[model samples]
Every structure is written in structure tokens, then in C-alpha cells.
Target: MSGSGAIVLNETVHQPTRLRIMSMLVSVDTTDPLAYGFLQNHLELTPGNLTTHLRKLEDAQYVAITKEFHGVKPRTWVQATAAGRHAFAEYLTNLERVLGVRARP
Candidate 1:
């Protein structure tokens, strides 16, 4: 809650698909990024759809994306930035406050 007694939500992290994406990324080890294909399959998003959402997250500096080659195949990996992790935590806190639920330790 803010000083004005209004619940403010982060629009960037609040979007449904992006929120799910953040949740998955935040759960993984920092050193081990998720593969693009895995996120697409798990989230049931098409390639173009996933890429658009990823671009938005990347533009916000909330996620880092890396493209590389594994033999003759190209691979893309995604990881949440430190700032992103903090933002996601704050978002959850605000959401909990709005729902009158206590946050977990």
C-alpha cells in the first residue's frame, strides 16, 4: 500500500503472460537460464507470441536474453535480472496487500 492508501501495481510485471514468465524464471537457479523452447512449450505460446513478450521484458531490463549456437542449432536462453527479481517480489507483496493476505517469509 502506498501513502495515499491506494494499491499500486507494476504494469510491466502485472501482465498475465509476463507474470507467468517472471514466476518461472525467478524459480530457476540464476546460473541456469531457461531455454526459449522450454518456456514456449511450457507456457503454450507460439514462437512469435513468446518473442514479443520476451522483447517487452528485455526492453524493461527485467530479463536478459542470450542467443548462441549449440553445434549447428541456435539456442536462446532467458534469465531474470536482479532488478527483475526485486520487482517481482515487490509486486507480489503489493498483490498480497490488496488481497488482505500476509506475505510469506
Candidate 2:
């Protein structure tokens, strides 16, 4: 490890894709629902790829996924939990602090 202190992120929101997902989710703050298709397109991920990331977040209790029937098709929507917002914010704070110190040198 470098001399700079290591930034430990909560495992629940640690992976890059999940981190991005969480960030996006927090940005919306449940005011607008994000469908699985929307996330898939926004992240440019295959359905399976997006599902894996979402499952991890949902398992960690950082995100909630709801499924409902839309006509004959099932639709999935995801939102960040309160814990997810807190964790993401904490990560941003630590990241900014680390960058600030590095910039000073």
C-alpha cells in the first residue's frame, strides 16, 4: 500500500458497478423509479450482468428491487435504501478527503 491511508469502503457498496448504481440511485432519491431496463441501458450492461450487480446490492440490503406485472410482462424497479445512501455518502467523503490531502502534497 502507498503511504496514503487506505480508504476502506463498506463491502455492501464496494464493487465499481454497484457503487455506480448506488450513486445513481441516491441521485434520484426514490422520487423517480429506475426500471431494470433503464439501468441496463444506462450502464450498458447485459441483462444478466445487470441482474448480478442488482442481486448483490439487494442482498446487501443497500437496494430494494420490486417486481410487478405490467400487462403480461413483469417489470423490475430498483431504489436505494437509506443505508445505501449513507454508505455511498460516507465513501464520497472519504474519497474527497484522500484526494484533498494528496493534492496538497
Candidate 3:
């Protein structure tokens, strides 16, 4: 697909918040799941807004959400799945195609 210049967009990951979410996740290691609170704070999104967007990502199987108990407290962590990683990479390629920006090797 590289050099073919075909612009293929991943609609699931194309939403503004979703795109931002994938960008952040791609920057971190796969095993390093982010806390729910951290995402809400960093994205500046309300709890309801985050929840809705997360549900969409989860439904697409692009993100995996884990809920565990920290003693009496409930903790939720989110990470991108392999599928998400691939989708994000493809999204970047599409963005580059749209911008006519060639990626450096």
C-alpha cells in the first residue's frame, strides 16, 4: 500500500476523540494500559463523553477495557489491541496521503 497512494480511512478511528485516543495509545507500550481517569483528564472529556467514545472503540474491538478491584475500589484500565495498532497505523498513512506528506523511513 505504501507508494500506491490509496487513501483509506478507518472510520472507527477517524472520530476526533477516537483519533486522539489512538494517538496517545500508540505512543505508549502495548502492555502499559492507561487508567480511565488519566484518559478523561488528558482528553479533557467528561465522564459521559469518554464512556460513549470508549464503548464505540470497544465494540469495534479496537480497544480492550479491563476492570479489576483494587481492594474496595474499582479500577478500569484501557489499552489498544493488536487490531487497534494496525488501524492506527493505517489511519496515519491515510492522513499522510491526504496531506501529501511522505513518511520518513
Who wins the TM-score comparison? 1
Error of 2 at 68 (Å): 0.1
- RMSD to native for every prediction? 1.6, 4.2, 2.6
Which tens-of-lDDT digit does each residue in 1-105 have in candidate 1? 568899998999999999999999999987879999999999999999999999999999989999999999999999999988998999998899889998568
Local error of candidate 2 at 80, Å? 0.4
lDDT of 3 by residue, 26-50 (tens): 7899999999999999999999999
The residue pairs found clashing in candidate 1 are none
lDDT of 1: 0.94
Residue pair clashes in candidate 3: none
Go through the candidates in order and give the clash count of each.
Answer: 0, 0, 0
Superposed by TM-score, candidate 2 places the C-alpha of residue 71 at a distance from the truth, in angstroms, of 1.0
Ranking by lDDT: 1, 3, 2
Residue 105 of model 2: what lDDT? 35
Error of 2 at 87 (Å): 0.7
Residue 45, candidate 3: how far off, in angstroms? 0.8
- Between prediction 2 and prediction 3, the one with superior TM-score is 3
lDDT (tens digit, per residue) of candidate 2 on 1-105? 236667665766777888878878998945566898988899888999889988888887878899999999999999988877777888777777657744343
User: Cα deviation of 61 in candidate 1 (Å)?
Assistant: 0.7
Error of 3 at 43 (Å): 0.8
